[model samples]
Target: MALTLVTGGTGHLGRDIVDRLVRAGSRVRVLARTPGVRSNVEWAAGDLAAGAGLQDALHDVDTVIHAATFSPIARRGGIRPIDFFRSPSAVDVEGTERLLACAEKAGVRHFLHVSIVGLDEATLPYARVKLAGERLVRASALSWSIVRAMPFYYLLDRLLAGLSWLPVWPVPTTRFDPVDTSDVADHVVTCAFDGQRGVRTEIGGPEALDLVAFARQYQDARRLHRRILPIDLSETKARGMGFVASQGVRGHLTWTDWLRRNSPEA
Candidate 1:
């Protein structure tokens, strides 16, 4: 049995990948901020920024799934744009370099990096950092796979939650194909076990919809009636997101289907 180390194992997608790997009978270890024991899974306390506890975590690990990230939205309230870039760069770019060095040293065979779909087209700081991380993975000597997935349904749910209180929801004109994290996880896990290497695959949800339509569907699912106000995005931003809307390996779950199954009862 091959040993796999999953970074950001506590995150939504990372956790799902861990679950899938465990169910598939693979030996799995996770690098977390606070490590502890879990059934069929080992944990190592580590901070990607500080490069601590990685040695123990990477020990005997044949493959690494680099799922750790510092998202900009998580710091929306108190963070500046430069700070936003700095934060993700620290983890996504610099931290990835640190991890790559250690993985190389440990003689890890395969590295599966989870990235965002249309990242190359995106201008956002987070996206840029993620793209940088991808480059690092590609440049590394180890065999690798880069999976670029669309925004997760859970992330959309959080967006809906943040805007649900408004009688009128202001939505950006940019389009999105929000995929389910579980579906993305399945792909990630599949790539982890598969022998294919040095491949870049993109995945997205079944349907492409603008933010207004997404908001309407979200409201209908929650049994809430709200007016949706379309906010015009800059042409550059729209074009970039439009590019994301155009390509990818589509997932099984549509936005409506995902909401129907996952949304709270009315």
Candidate 2:
């Protein structure tokens, strides 16, 4: 059946998007390497990197809410300095092109892409890969919308969790405005149905805080005590890479609120 196809449906943000779509009563399909068990949702087994199952996944689909990105560096705990230079050309780059082509062939009406902010200002290889994917979407023949969002609180939460054994919190500090995944999903669904095109203003949480502040709040919420030894990040305003949206609208949830709701210490 024709539906609103969501790429990366198994992911954190993609899962929320799919759930919201299903709850909103839009016929929904999800693209994943393994099929999902969500009721009323059709899961198409597909790998973006390999270009398999895209035709069947996109077939007769009129809208696409894409939240997929490839970053093995992230998957491996983001500690490798060398892996930072690696580009997601195969998945985000080539796979984006493949998806767009197949979607056009299926006569998809709107293609919504999810991206992080500061891709233009950041020199990171991951940013470049995401930019390349955005380019493919913009240049595609199908109608398109790109939603740039701030870093999620889960990112810092995970990073801190991985480093919880450290004696001191020695970390690079930078400005960040983390958003909730559900808020991003809501905005994505709204944009998907609004029928507008082109890149919209970035979206983030209510307040902007640096990495040190975020860490402190996290430690407090998790009932951990560690002295912060911060390294100053200079030269670029985009210190957290794409984590801060330069000028953007704010979502309702704040980092503290997210912590209060999700953290076990709460």
Candidate 3:
């Protein structure tokens, strides 16, 4: 069997993708910078940033799902003003260039690149960086598909958890369309099997909710009594922070349903 090689297989979306692929009986291999815990699938010791071990990982792989991404600022919690001016990080750009090059040499049949939904919001560094990876895939000689997924639910859940102990939850007047990670995972797996080329149907949540209402629903779901304070996000929105597609292939899971599933108290 021509194995399917997945990059970032241990990451948030990558983990879910790997699970679905394995369940579907596809031979799976994951490229990881370090050792991974999951013993079910084959793990290729590699570093995308260093462009090492890719040749070995891509060997005999017919499908490639490029999900690995890097952003130090986001990892550290929040982005600073100066972060915008600095050049975007390396993994998505240099790593992807190298990955595509190696995949071509290894005769990859299909290259599916996982990307965020808001490339039009390229004013933001993260979106810009994602675009870079997308460009590399499109320009590559291999058959390629890009799945543009909306922000994951975990992002919002983490934001709210930070203020769970506070008396008031200060949320922006801005709006967003976030999808459950598992739902997005379903879309990715479906696309991989469908084997289409070019950018696929953009996916997002069922409804785009206002931040205040979103947080209120969250606080209520969590059985908390914090006052929901709505603050203006005009500046942030102007910078394209609210860049998720207002509409897309809507996910079946609503934010409320997702909260209940993820939070024990909810």
Clashes of 3: 0
Which lDDT tens digits does candidate 3 get at residues 1-266? 66999998988888999999999989999999887888789999999989999999999999999989886554555456766765454789999999999999999999999988877665767777878888888899999998988888877787787788889777777667888878888998899878578889989988887778889888888888999888886654733764444456888899999899888854
Cα lDDT for residue 152, model 1? 82
| 10 residues in a row with least lDDT, candidate 1 | 75-84
TM-score of each: 0.91, 0.94, 0.90
TM-score of 1: 0.91
lDDT of 1 at 45: 85
Clashing pairs in 3: none
Instruction: For candidate 1, give the lDDT.
Output: 0.82
Error in Å for residue 95 of model 3: 0.8
**Local distance difference test, each candidate:** 0.82, 0.83, 0.83
Per-residue lDDT of model 1, residues 29-130, tens digit only? 999998766867988889898888888889999999999998866434223457434444788988899999999999999989988877667766677778
Off by over 4 Å in 3: 77-83, 165-167, 233-239, 264-266
